[model samples]
Target: MRRGASASHLDAAAAVDAALPAWLGLPNNAEKVLLTLRAARVAATARGVAATALGVAATAPVVAATALATTMAELLQRLFELQEGHKELLQRHEELRQRRM
Candidate 1:
């Protein structure tokens, strides 16, 4: 089951990499980096959603709910950072491509 999930994730990453403009000229390793970043962002988003759901469903105490919200917010921040990093990597890839031309 775990292996299947990993394979699914890899397939998703490959699809995302393939959809990007080839003119960007990112290498395979760079593509992998993008994939990892994207996965991290997704995980963070899932965590945030789960946390929110749990808080709501459990009727957590105000303090506990606040903490969960804060954690979820931090996860969101991490996701944004991962996205930014991915963008930077793509930008760098493009710059390198232009330089090679």
Candidate 2:
């Protein structure tokens, strides 16, 4: 909110970062990131499996590219999840310490 981010965007980002493990912070968001990772992984695997089963060996490069893209997406998602959770933590810390006086 301090960033002047739109309410809906903030809420959507929060929603993404919720439902995850407490270890990941914002359980919901973490879960979302994990889900995205899982989905991407599944897609990559399916592409590979399909190509192999179809015996279209010439498509290996394309399949590999798809897998790489998915992997990069998963990494970026995890980074965003971590960043969003950190913002909440920093705000909480600032608020709590202010009341200690």
Q: List the residue pairs that clash in candidate 1.
A: none
Q: Give per-residue CA lDDT, model 2, range 30-98, as digits (tens).
A: 645565676567666765665675565645555345554566567666766775676688578878988
- Candidate 1 residues lying further than 4 Å off, grouped into runs, are 1-65
Residue 21 CA displacement from its true place in model 1, Å: 7.2
Q: Please, what are the lDDT tens digits per residue for candidate 1 over residues 18-101?
A: 675454776646655665677677766666576566654333444344565677668767867776687788789889999999
Model 2 per-residue lDDT at 99:
95
Give each model's whole-structure lDDT.
Answer: 0.68, 0.63
Cα-based TM-score, every candidate: 0.42, 0.36
Clashes of each: 0, 11
